[model samples]
Target: MRVITVEEHFHHPEVGPRVMDLSGPPPIDLDADFSTFWRNFTPDRELAEQLAGGRLEHMDAAGINIQVLSHGAMTPGSLDHPDATGLCRQVNDWLAEQISQYPTRFRGFATVPLYDPKAAADEMRRCIDELGFVGTLTQGTFAGLFLDDPRFEPVLAAAEELNSPLYVHPGIPPASVLRAYYSGNWPASVEFLLSSPAFGWHAEAGIHILRLILSGALDRHPGLKLLSGHWGEMVAGWLDRLDEAIGWGHYLDRPVSDYYRTQVWITPSGMYSHNQLKFFLAEVGADRIIHSEDFPYVVRTNVADFLLNADIADHEREAIAHRNAEALLRISPL
Candidate 1:
């Protein structure tokens, strides 16, 4: 069976040196710049290969056929540099070159300068039309602002007009959020186990996607395609409770489930739990779910075996593995 992994990650190889070279350094905190995720990434030979050309070797080792890669998420100060717009173009073009090298085995989502929404949308268009990218992926808030803001309407409008999907990846909580809930210094191992990204990012992702729903962005562009990973950041679990607003019938034009079922897609990146997958299937149906490995982050390469051995039937497994991603991304099956 063809296995298309949608939650793969990459950082622009030039990003670090480029950021360090910026003229006026931006504020380094999470009020806007929250990259507890990628700020500290240091590449070894193995990591370098994964970020660049040698990705195919690992995919072959894992027995996966194709991978859909995206930059992890944008932190506030990342693109706040004077040369940010140019950097966005550079990253998107570099990804296009990488995909062009192995058009069959790899494809990528575009990275935009989210600090400027119009520039972001314009780059999104350029990636999709000019570079042949599948779509665009961003994570968390836009400089501490959610997508519902009118400033982002151009981005949403472009996604609708161009038929490009927008993926909301997980992001870290802001400084205030971390200070309130995840504050305190423990040993490095203890922080990694407790507050690092494992617990905080998933909740942050879950909340961001939900905010889009409650903030009525979905209602504006009903045709917009949005994606969430890790079983929708646990949206399936909390969806019903969120729908309690249906009792009053006061706020939304439709129930939250309607928006989720019709507008959103979910992937199980690095989450191989059969129970969680089963619950997502029951709640959102197989069509809205897809398969992903989250790549180097969760670093277990036996996903083909896991999906093949999952308790679900052959048809459902196949749908999650390739069918849904094929339809959404327009990639042919291997």
Candidate 2:
């Protein structure tokens, strides 16, 4: 199978440290082995910084033919930093340079400074038109304001005009939300995990996409395409309920699920469960599904085996493996 993973990540070693630090307090739990957990789960920094040799070798070992790389944890800094315009430009330039080195084995997703809508739009244009990036990635929200906030219209407009899909990766919840909702239930370690990857992050990304639909952002920018990780950030399972509940209000031009059908795409992001594959295939169909490993952070034992052995037709497997990504991101198939 010609596998093309779209949610792989890269960290710009030189530029990462300069961004403002918004990461909240470290885990203070005394009960859980937080240190050991992170030690095992944290991605290797050297591997993340190496675009040519180390990463490529790992891909070869795992049978990944292509990786669509985007900035990882530091991605939100582009929107939070005071000098985001310059920082985002530098970040995108460096990523473009890296992709140029392994043009066929690698692809890029632009990192834009969503804090400045006009600058974000210009950078998205430059990355897609000039740098040859397939699209852009956003780490959910910036300064607690989701993209549906009217201030981000220019970025949405640019995405539509440029025909670029915005990959909505999960971002850390703001401090206030962290304190109010996710804290106090258990050990700080559990709280931290709950507020992030274990639960909060996916919920936040799902809400972000729904806000784009409900807040009229998608209606205004109808041509804009959205890519969500972790099986549409849990939205794939809830579309029916969402459409049912939102139908009571009936605010938009169509049902909430219609936007998902037309404008959204989803990837497993390393959640390689056959049950999930079966459910998502039934819920959204094969066309809306794509492939990803969520790389380094989510290193699966059976990297390619899940899709390779899916209980589906050959064409469906091919679509999830590479064809859907090729069509969505305009990547040329090998």
Candidate 3:
């Protein structure tokens, strides 16, 4: 079966380092597993910036026929740089060039300057219509506010109008959230992990989805396509609770779970847990589940094997592996 993984990430050669604080010193002397797995984890930065020669080889090794690349956690969209709008155009132009090199094996998700909603919407349109990008990705929050904030409606409206899916990637928490919840009681490295990949990042992403639902963004833009990774960022497991509890005082046109089922698509994002996959398959159905490796971060090369051995029917497996992504993202099948 052909495998297409979304949620694959890469770093922009120039703009990435300038905005994302990539020069921090590595943390040392911690628990072996946490330190080795996360704290000491260093991705191949050169390979991250490479496409034709480097990333394609890794994709072949892992049996991924195509990868939809997007800027990772700290995307230009989440920053407050003075030249953010120009930087976003530059980044998307670079990404479009890379995808043009191997249009079959590589696709792109545009990086928008979310700090300015109108400019972000314009960039998103240019990416989809002119550059042939599949969609746009909004990384976490902008100025500590999630997409549900009224200021972000223009981008949301553009997405609905363009029939493009918006991939919601996690981002670093606001300082207040970091200090209040993830600090104190651990080393700085541990605190950083706590605020990021360990727990906070997923929760932050999940909360944004809930806010969109409760705040009626989904209701207003009912045709919006919101994609979530990490198996819907823990929201898939709690749909029942969210619907049941929030249902009591709900004022929306539909139930919370209904919006999830209709509007949201979920990917595992390299967390290869069979139980989680099974739960999502039941909760959201196979049509809503897509495959992703979160490449260079998780780096599990046995992706084909994992999906092939999954305890699902052949049709369902096909849907998760490539069919769903092709349908949702409009990729041509091999």
C-alpha local distance difference test of each model: 0.74, 0.85, 0.86
* True-vs-predicted CA distance for residue 107, candidate 3, Å: 0.6
Candidate 3, superposed: residue stretches over 4 Å from native: 21-39
Clashes of each: 0, 0, 0
Best to worst by TM-score, what's the order?
2, 3, 1
Give me candidate 1's TM-score against the actual structure: 0.88
Which parts of model 1 are misplaced by more than 4 Å? 20-54, 73-78, 188-196
The lDDT, on a scale of 0 to 1, for candidate 3 is: 0.86
- lDDT digits (tens) for residues 1-334 of candidate 1: 7899888877666664565566243322333224443354433435533544456767887777888888753322235555667887887777788788788888888877777788888988999999988888886664567677788888889988888888888664555665566655544333433443567767777777778788888877878999988888877677787788553767887888888889899988878888887888889998898888887666667778878888988889899889999999888766
Candidate 3 global TM-score:
0.93
Tens digits of lDDT, candidate 3, 1-334: 9999999988888888666563233223344465556535668876678886767787888889999999874467777766778878888899888888888888899898877899999999999999999988888787789999999999999999999999988887877788888877667677878888899989999998989999989889988999999999989889999888887876767778999999999999999988888888999999999999997788887888788989999999999999999999999876
Per-residue lDDT of 1-334 in model 2, one digit per residue for the tens?
9999999998878667566344334323345576777677668987788787778888888889899999887664345655777877888889888888888898999988877889899999999999999999999678789889889898899999999999988987887887787888576677778989999989999999999999988888889999999999988799999999999887777988899988999999999989999999999999999899998788775667888888999999999999999998999877
In model 2, which runs have C-alpha deviations exceeding 4 angstroms? Answer: 20-40, 76-78
Error of 3 at 186 (Å): 1.1
Residue range with the least summed lDDT across 10 consecutive positions in model 1 = 25-34
What's the best-to-worst order under lDDT? 3, 2, 1
